[model samples]
Target: MAKRQPRDTLPTHIAQWRDQVRRDYGIEDAPGLILLEQAALALHRAEQARELLAKDGLVTRDRFDQPKPHPAAVIARDAEASFRAALRDLQLDVEPARPVGRPPGV
Candidate 1:
């Protein structure tokens, strides 16, 4: 009998599946690129939110009172909190926030 791979190797399998989907769906060029770009943007925003929360310890309304905050900051904060909560529920290691001395340019 062949040895089975660990579940941790599933990501490679999933990527192959996604590649098959792209081929089967005939995904190419502009529209496909746009979708891929959007996915990348979403992932970038999620990472930003995660970092913000991890640095600031909490999202406060005051954070929005700054001279300029991207309009998406609030949405990002909410999403980050939800993600963290979900991680906690799943018994995953939730990264605790590290205190940042002061707001930027303060």
Candidate 2:
């Protein structure tokens, strides 16, 4: 019998997702990580769904004539929505507030 190898847990951690977001978005600040973390799980699922759809051409229904989005596409769509919403909610974090008053210690 073959010995079972330990499963890699990197994919399940938030830091991994954070790293992915950084690489994907070329983010350089903590705010970007924070935003991605908000929708980490959904983003991960969306990526997985996209990969599945790309590779398998998954068609949930073959008996019907009407064309429809693949199940993976649906998952990707919902996940993308969640990801975008998270980013939208954190827009302020990405754009720093400008100081309206005079310079300090002028």
Candidate 3:
């Protein structure tokens, strides 16, 4: 059997975030990057959890046929909370994403 490569754990958007952080705050240090990584990981986890919830539905039946909330819901909720806290702690003061295409007054 061929040896499987280890999974890449880095967030897909880390580069974009890093660039913004560097441009806006001049933070190119280990601590800042670590915090950013944490935030990104939390967001990734939350997204994955949400996907699972969507696939499984919001509520599911147990072995007893009793309806219960999808377990992924909690994971998504907690991960989202973690992402928010990490962003807050980073203190980058990022602006909200602007609407795409066309200038507002053009």
Q: Which candidate has the highest TM-score of all?
A: 3
Please report the TM-score between candidate 2 and the true structure: 0.49
State the displacement of the C-alpha of residue 64, model 2, in Å, after optimal TM-score superposition.
5.4
RMSD of 1: 18.3
For candidate 2, what is the lDDT?
0.72
Per-candidate local distance difference test: 0.53, 0.72, 0.79
TM for candidate 1 is 0.36
TM-score for every candidate vs. truth?
0.36, 0.49, 0.69
TM-score of 3: 0.69
In candidate 1, what are the lDDT values of residues 1-106, reduced to their tens digit? 9998763222344446445645665657676644533433444456666677667655344555745454357768665556455434434344767777986787
Best by lDDT: 3
Runs off by more than 4 Å, candidate 2 = 1-36, 63-67, 92-106
**Which pairs clash (backbone N, Cα, C closer than 3 Å) in model 3?**
none
Worst 10 residues of 1 by lDDT: 6-15
Clashing pairs in 2: none
Error of model 1, residue 44, in angstroms: 0.7
Report the C-alpha displacement of residue 84, candidate 3, in angstroms.
0.6
